[model samples]
Target: MTVYSSNVTRGLMLAAAFTAVVSRSSLRDLSSVSPIGYRIGFVTPQRLWTSSNSGRGSRPIGQIGQQHNGASWEEISNPKSSKTVKLFKAIHKANKSRRNEIGLTVAEGVRLVADLLSTENEHSKSLVRRVVISDALKQRAESPDGDQYHRELIYRLREADKKSRASRDKANAIIINTGGKDAVQACCGTVTSQGIAALVEIPTYNLDELSSEGEEEGFYLILDGLADPGNVGTICRSAVASGVRAVLLLESSCDPWSPKVVRASMGASFRLPVIEVPGDNALDRISDALKIDPKRIFAATMESSGDAGASKAHFDVDFTARPSAIILGREGEGLRPKIREALSNGRISSVHVPMSDGVESLNAAVCASIICFERCRQFAQKKSDDL
Candidate 1:
């Protein structure tokens, strides 16, 4: 009887220990759960989750799985193994020559990709080479509760693929699923990716395309040696918004097709005609292309005492009066010597945006935006007067 009692007591003690361990583990797991009920491990870099009120524990909508009809889903566990993934990485780092050789650039984020797909221009729409999406994005797009924009994007992607297969076009955009956020992030240029990106064929345009002979008198934006990709991209956005005829990028300028510039442009690069001008006698080449005298070109310069010619305020110039080109220079260096010489020689006039006494200069992008919008305001006022 003594042995039996001892054995029973030992067994009870073991059971109690097991229960305590289990209870501790349960508490730990419960503590790890977010207030919204989503597991912390499941949260994406994009933080694409919201609280659910249905009492069903919250899960990232993007992580939910549903098969999209007619879409070919492939698992890309390793980025190195996939040629498409490698191509995307390469394009992101490519120089002008390499990018030209590849004839491709990347457009990331949901909005940019959607804009590219939905553009009214058939040529621009056709430029989509491939669409790389995260498995989460694909799943979310298929979910009934997903955003309408995401759903439409997925549908368009499928349609685009189907049309390509039907037409047997070699240039059809392949829809790829990375199977997770990591692989998609591998192909993105941004620090925090949107889990979706598209490879787009770079469109080439010649100087002649910038001509606005038959239409309204138009102005052009000449980016002379603007090295900052962000500034270049922002200028492109402004140029498009202000109805600039085309953006002339000098040889020394940063690659306008670079991912940073494209993102800054906010898809404006896809819409605008961007021409590359030779570094040598770029002004003359621009003059020849527009068939306008050199005097029509205006260089944006800072106010200086040693200036060769008196600079006019941006608003004083009547951009609508004739076919004009506004040349913006590098951030620190301003215009190249030849350009400055042109300003001094009365070949091209110099213009400046007036500023307060303390400020030395505005950011290249900010300056470009201000000047471009001033032209826009002038055009609007002119239109109002005509009415």
Candidate 2:
């Protein structure tokens, strides 16, 4: 007697299969059936209502009891359900361009959701559109060790629902209890759910907003055509750690929302402004966005001299003087001609890490981390001196 709105395709099938039951049964009784229940009762071909009638004293036709698994639960066992298919596509689709068309990203693992919960801000909680919880994790929630963040996740789910009532499209957050491990694997294809994963709204960002903030003392990290997700993620993590105001990804850079990048970022992406600048006059756009002179920006490179500028040792640059940006180019090719031109003209200074005779260069991420910390060190010293 599960009453699925005609919207649920399976419910339509069930309704079609048992037209006689709908004739006599009350809609209220049929609607009472929990969507999570294993079996639903309906009239047999003989036109008799299902369920035992002898001891029950002729219970109402199509009457259903509350589901044992509890309320507000929908079990998604079919791998082909539209909902399941949509989730699978969002989780597995790795191409950045395609993901942009859909505008949603999958964030898996309990630790990531825990990081979201730690923020305790309404906007952060609202970003979570759905949280998929596996039955195994639900059972484990009864134990001390396995229950970490489980209750908090559930709480956030309720909070989302509560906020949804107050605002339009603010919180579409749903807590899905996929009643089996196989179902969880199907959703994420992971050996384990780590308890839960969320499909969150990847927050939108613009360069102007990033540039406007901390104008007097901003530190912006610009990834110029860098394609490595791990490098991008770690650099973002370091950017936040070293007090950067924002992180900008050039149009050619890897998608910050990719699962690998999001995972490697360790939740720092959510904490900072990570934006994409279109390749058309990209540097010009950045220059226009900033309140300070474009000359404050510096480009990091491997060689002492490029097509344009002569590189200076990292420490020679004065990061503490004003709001500035550090540009890290692709892993091997270094900066493009226009970027190098900016460097050569003294608009964008080139900074390189000092290396031993044998060492050519460090990994892109490592170099970024080193320079970010150096900037942090300078800022720390400046703060101390002012005191």
Candidate 3:
């Protein structure tokens, strides 16, 4: 409370009036600020001046929340009530009928989803219906220090979305944010969730589609009553690596679209054509698909002293001679009666992976891998010899 000169008092009064006008103008401009700077606008004096810039040639506040990449980010607070979440749960529960009805399945884990997203196949890319990511994961992925793979996945998703929007064909994946880690974890089928998942449409194929081009030789893998998902998945992965034309699953076989199988296959299910043979005459249908003599089909059997001449070692079979179909049966039980009867009648040949004495048998997956790779090795050698 000190006295001031007349000139100083007048200047103080002018400053007070100016400050009052600015406070009033800022309050008016607060409503025009974007969500990005809403809280800062109230505390920072410069933000008050920036609001006018938004209207005078700067980016509009309305456009601030819009992604330039055309991808839509939706926050799901109640994932329990979300339709995507329900679908994910249904797929995870292995409700085969429901899955078939919807024609959709879930692919979890970052690597698995990333693989699907990054694939160049248009059909494969179109199969990705949705990508569900946790909000925390999204933030981490967008962070400066995030993994390059993770960032690339995000960029690819956004670019895919943009392409879909431009084409208006719904070929892109819809991105969903679960808003929390728990929601994403609850949707995952694995013990440790990676906070990301994708809904994939099951691809359909026909017998005609299984045929190879021209004289290019290839083989088919038939799963006869293979109920173990792990074994089936591993075999599928090996088949794809060894270049099988397609995988045929008998009606008695486990669902190839199941989460456990998809996980164990490590994305091979999406890359390879998996067809289901529904009727009891699966062998006939498979033979027709192969378009080869039934004798070319080989049944994988275990080695035994009693069946020395009856079965040939897998490597001994001339797989490069013609197109072939290899049949791998369920674990514990070797081949079904139908397959054994066919083998005995010379309708199909019996092949066994030679094992050392004292070993009863190899895992079904291991057995398939050995035979498939051996076929590949033989064909490769034959190609080199011809060259």
Candidate 4:
């Protein structure tokens, strides 16, 4: 018989209604009584035993099968909260798979439930279609891996809700909503489960506003003309593999935070910082930011009066000798002179993968991988030399 715990408020209110069932002699054959079901808390092992019989006292909460459609799903019952109700429906639709597969995507942590309330995308608003959180399990998420990294993650979740309304609106465009009530808490738990999202879009950043930041000591990949989402996404992955800590995109570059880019990065976009600057002074702005010597800045192009001419093998450059950055040109046009000129006085330099006589050059991301690994390999070699 379908049974419910006393914790299920709606069901408990109906207990008087349940007590009436026992009087019907027609229901004497224990199994003959209709199974009573209600939207209630999960049944624990102890509660499971009690449920087999027909008693009417409170039972302790316990872990059992959690429906994916969720228990604490609160429909927008109050007419005053119409917006919230719409969102509930949308989330239910988006999470259909998790509900079907796991029968347990609905989390039980309070903080996780809180996070679910903060959905800030358009698509997500649709998801908060009208569902409410039904139950929050008492168990909480662990304290992250440790002190340092743990704080950073907490900061991301807390700060994500406080950002501009404009940004939160972008979240409304997708199935990713957080910063709300019941369903919102569910949403936050769903994404944070991975310990990291594959791609997290800065909902507010337009091409004009994205800015790059990095250590003065390591390399960053400056994507010039690689606008294709697939190419941008792959290069993001390549950046991480090659040990590049960040990605700097030119004005003409594709939005790295776009859904396409997010999907393509396969999650590197979350781990790597991506920034953008205006197209007019793209190179000029980068020079001003990292603030490393102009001579150390390297562009991925060959030009007259360029550093590539004087440099040793792309692999031969003393990567460990000083801090550096790699600047990639358009997928086809290569780096413009303005780009090369921006670094002539700075610590920036340039590198080119030598073609074995015929092939013109590699794809932007591929070329970036070669340059990045060469530099990383150089750094590793330098450390060994020091030891």
Top candidate, metric lDDT: 1
Best by TM-score: 3
For candidate 3, the lDDT comes to 0.68
Per-residue CA lDDT of model 1 for 223-326, tens digit only, reads 88999988988888888788877889887898998988888887888787787888687788888768766777888888644444688888888887778878
- Rank ordering of all candidates by lDDT, starting from the highest: 1, 3, 2, 4
Supply the TM-score for candidate 2: 0.73
Q: Write the per-residue lDDT of candidate 3 for residues 332-361, one digit (tens) a residue.
A: 887889888998788888788888878988
In model 2, where is the ten-residue run with the lowest total lDDT? 39-48
Q: List the residue pairs that clash in candidate 1.
A: none
Clashing pairs in 3: none
Q: After superposition, how far is residue 187 of candidate 2 from its true place, in Å?
A: 2.6
Computed on alpha carbons, the lDDT of every model, listed in order, comes to 0.69, 0.62, 0.68, 0.45
| Model 2 CA deviation exceeding 4 Å by range | 1-72, 147-172, 189-195, 211-214, 304-309
- Per-residue accuracy of model 2 over 1-387 as CA lDDT, tens digit each: 122122244333333322322222333333332232222221111111334323664322222121223345556556454344344444455366544433446677766766665545444454555556677776665456655476666555555544433443312323344446655665563565575666655665556545465467778888988998899999988987889888888768888988778777876787777778877688778777876567777788776754544777788788887778889989888887789877767776778899888998799899989988998888888899999
- Angstrom error of the Cα, residue 101, model 3: value is 0.9
- By lDDT, the better pick of 2 and 4 is 2
